[model samples]
Target: MSSIAFMTQAQEYMFTYSKLFSHLKQNVKQGHEDVKVGLFFLNADTKKNCVIQKAWMEKEQHYEELKTTRYNELLLPLDDNLKSANPLVFVRTPQDQRCDFSMVVMTKQPLKGTVSYTEVEMLLPQMQVMLEDLGGMFASWFTPDVEGVTLEFQGLVDGQVEFSNGKTKPIVNGKAQVALSDIGQGGSMILPQETSRVLPYLPRAD
Candidate 1:
């Protein structure tokens, strides 16, 4: 699947998971007054697992050219023979063990009662990129004009990248309000106006 298509799929999964999270908060009522949803991309700026990190970095850089808005290649881990394996998403518990969070994106069913065999998987290349740049996976989706959508991806290619350590570099971060009408815009929904108002010194990607 192309990058655009992958974004759409990921959004759908996010929506599904979000709804499921909401349901869990409501249903498992310890009369639980506090309720929240949405899973964050945890530790997004740093590596979490060494094995996964090595596999991802070793993959050929997606593209050769170095551009500010694009990303390089991504790699996924697999069995010894280079076969694909399902990527696992989990939260770290205080016990130092991986706790299985009930995620709806991976499974179509409720994660409470039965064994959830659903494995949410995506091509590693789809994720290995500077997510907040012009040509990155997040760029187009974040547009203000974009509303509810199910994007169809065309193709995939290796791409360019800009140089700098991730920590100091500033991405075009801005605030956005995702009303019900703006459901399909993925994580970013910052408008040009809001971005301009908040980030006066931001550089133009184009």
Candidate 2:
């Protein structure tokens, strides 16, 4: 039988908040209000398991790391909240699936002085609930695709292969295939070397 398999390869995906920043800046300017920025994995199923590799703010030649209090959350520093900084997050999901991350830039009442860790910890539960509620409103504020090359395979038999997103697939017949929607870029799927040979072909739309 001929099949196409997806092999896991630890792919890196980036989440950015350029549009969210613009929206928040305008709101802050008009209302003369302080705003807080946060990043969250809104999907209940994958939020906890998702691994955040790194996060940072970028503007021209300057880049600074953004600290995370938990695996699922990253609250922006209050000193220069969103000023001209573009936030970027590098993450790896446990498996190849739809990305459900959200960027939340909400108006916040100003707090005096610096915020301590204890205060932040206490506020986390409320923040989580609020962010999740706002997620759907700003769903289009960022692009939700994983960056990587796509490959295809052919002339394979029943077996299993790993995927870049850390998920494995079992090839039932020589015809198991990965859906195009599951993969952003167009190309073919990658298969294990020992199982079968693959042929490269033009990508087709789902």
Best by TM-score: 2
The per-model lDDT (C-alpha) reads 0.20, 0.40
- Name the lDDT value of residue 193 in candidate 2: 42
Query: Candidate 2, residues 1-206: lDDT per residue as tens digits?
Result: 11112234644345455544443333334232333444554445533324454656665676777666443455454434554454553444455544455555332432223223243233333333333334455633432321121222234445654444455556654433433333223322345542221111113323
TM-score of each: 0.16, 0.31
RMSD of 2: 19.4
Best by lDDT: 2
The per-prediction tally of clashing pairs is 4, 14
**TM-score of predicted model 1?**
0.16
lDDT of 2: 0.40
lDDT of 1 by residue, 54-119 (tens): 111122333121111011111122232222222222222222222222211111111111111111
Q: In model 1, how large is the Cα lDDT of residue 43?
A: 22
